[model samples]
Each structure stands twice: as C-alpha cells, then as structure tokens.
Target: MPFDQPLPREVKVTDSASLFRLEERACDLSLNSRLDPAWVRANAALDGAHYLWPALWNSLAHRPEVPRQLRCELLITLRAGDRVVSWLDVLPADFNPLPRVTSREEGMQVSQLLDRAPSVREWLLREGGGSGQQ
Candidate 1:
C-alpha cells in the first residue's frame, strides 16, 4: 500500500477497536492544557507531559504501516507560560516480511508496546504518543 493512498477496505478500521482508537485520539488532541510552571512541576518534567493515550493509540492504529528501518515520531506541544515546548515519542513498526511473512516479529513489536501501557497512559495524560519520555 502506498503511503499517499488510503487503507484498503479490508483494513480500513471500521470495527469497534479501530473506531474507539480514533475517538481516543480525538480526545487526546482535545485534552491539551496550558503548561504553567505549577503544572510542569506537578508532572516532574515538562517533557513528561503528553497529549493523551487515546491519541497515541489512535495514531498508531490509524497508520498501521510504519516502516521498520525508519524511526517514527509523534510530537505533542504544551504551552508553558510564554514558551511552547514540544515532546516527541516513537511508534515503531515494520511493514516487511522478515524471517518470512506471518512471522512473530511484528506481533512482538506491538506486544512490547502494549506491555508498556502504564508509561503510555502517563504519556497520554501528559505530550501525545505513549512513550513516557521524549
């Protein structure tokens, strides 16, 4: 599938999981708050802040074809006083047949991320993608 084109009907994400993911992302996007010093301090670090988890999940689910060799970046911005800071996280995926097609590498990659939900949740509450750090 070409990046410029849309997902095919079979994987277009019409099911509950995909739809919910999209909704979650929308919520994350809408949850941005002004980053006051107190807010930053409460969060420990400005970089610790994220756009919300739903956004991250939705983002990943929305574009399920991230190239393995390439690093993916998702940026979330916060307004701290007069400064707007950006936090970046990665959503790594491999869209090739490695160790042959239908291999477990892809599954493991996704599973590894899913296992880090605590960090991802914190991230969702704080910059955008689920990684705890920028």
Candidate 2:
C-alpha cells in the first residue's frame, strides 16, 4: 500500500504471535518527570515502532476487514509543574494512523507510565500526521 494514500480495507499481517514478539522487543515510550521529545522521536524511528500498524492488524487479519481500534494513554510531565495525561485511540482504517490525543489531563502527580499502550500507535504516527506530543 502507498504511504500517501488511505489505508486499504485489508492488510497482510504475519500473525498475532509476531506482534507479541515485536512488542516484547519494543522500547518503552513513557515519560516520567521530564518530557523528553527526543526520546519520543528516537523510539518512533525504531524498527519495532515503525511496524506497529502491521502488529496492530496482525490479530484482525483473519476476521472480516473492519476498523481496528485500541484506546491508549500517554503520560507527559508538563514544564509547568504538572503532568499532562493524554488518551488516544488508534484507528488504522484512517489515512492518518497516528493515535491522536482525544482527552487530556493536567496536574496529576503520577509516575511509571504505561509505555507500550501508545507506543504502537503514537510512535508510528507522531512525526507524520499528528500535532501534539505525549
């Protein structure tokens, strides 16, 4: 499929097991007290992160071609002494596949982010189609 065009109705996927393997080898994209943009960029450039779409659709390969969606969260430490919590859901059927932040939070004192949840979605589309950072 062409990268410039919308995602096709069906995508060829290896398998769910393959996705797990990719996830196991993927990096953690969670931010702690400091919001490092470079970390997000670097991890997004990684091979595992780049192939997130294939992994995300691997399980649905067998089912009828339909929208594949997953809700995920990203924790970012704001420079203003607060934490900006972002939630996004990935819809691979769209032309822009990045997990755009649908909800946001502020001043939440929390640590240890759930990195894997958004890495597959956020990391892949961060540089291409989205405007905010996690």
Candidate 3:
C-alpha cells in the first residue's frame, strides 16, 4: 500500500487467539519504545473487533528503518465485546504497537495529543470530515 492510500475502516477478528498473537507481537515490538506494552495490556482488554485508521505514517516516511508495509498501514483499535478497549500503532519491523490511549476519556486525550503534531492533526481533520457525525 502506498502512503497516499487509506486503510479499511474496520477489521473483524473472530478468533480471540489470533488477536492475542497480534497483540503479543505488537507488545514485544513495543518494548524499549515509547509505548509501554505491559501498561497497555493491563489497562485494555484487547479481544474483539479491530478498528483501523491511518496514523502518523507520513512522519515516519523519511526513516529507512521503518518497513514499507508498516509505513502505509493503519493503526489498530481493540474492542472487547462492545466496549472500546485500546488503540495501538502496530510497527512490526521497528517497535510494535505504540499504545496510544484507552477508554472514551483517553480517546479525547489522544485527540488532543495528536493535535500537537501538525501533520497528524491535519490528516485527522481531513479524514474525519465525512465520518457521518454531524
């Protein structure tokens, strides 16, 4: 996928085990990085439908170390049952899912955090325009 392309909105994982594996891989990659995998696992119940959206990929495009597959990928949101559990930026090549935030409150917090990054804020605002939310 190219950096200009957008990812699918949602990815359903019927198997909890598969989700676990993905999470484990993400967690392992996350270690020694900006995100704390243990804290993410402890806070969020990552076992349900996975939502995806393009994250701050453009910011990482200049880095040769980041894989192309991951550079144009989407961020993952784990939902356990009906509740939104966690948000992760999965980086398999480098450091894994950099856990962003959890819960509704944290979601808002992350939004604020994203706003601090100009590129991300612009991308989000542009992408969010036709989301059908009034």
Computed on alpha carbons, the lDDT of every model, listed in order, comes to 0.29, 0.31, 0.37
lDDT of 1 by residue, 54-125 (tens): 112123444445321211121223233222222222122221111221335744443343344343246546
Which pairs, if any, clash in model 2? none
Q: What TM-score does candidate 2 reach? A: 0.22
- Write down the TM-score of every candidate: 0.21, 0.22, 0.35
Can you rank all candidates by TM-score, best first?
3, 2, 1
5-120: candidate 2 lDDT, tens digit per residue: 43333222222233333233222312121123443443332222121221122223454343343332434332222223343333444214433223233111122333323433
* Better candidate by lDDT, 2 or 3: 3
Ranking by lDDT: 3, 2, 1
Question: Higher-lDDT candidate among 1 and 3?
Answer: 3
Tell me how many clashing residue pairs each candidate has.
9, 0, 1
Over 1-134, each residue of candidate 3 has an lDDT whose tens digit, in order, gives 45685543223232334344545665554421122334334423455333333344433445566444332222223332222323344453422343323466755543443334233224336546221111
**Model 2 / residue 103 / CA error / Å:** 27
Q: Which ten residues in a row have the lowest lDDT in candidate 2?
A: 49-58
Q: Give the TM-score of candidate 3.
A: 0.35
Stretches off by above 4 angstroms in model 3 are: 31-63, 68-82, 91-134
Give me the candidate number with maximum TM-score: 3
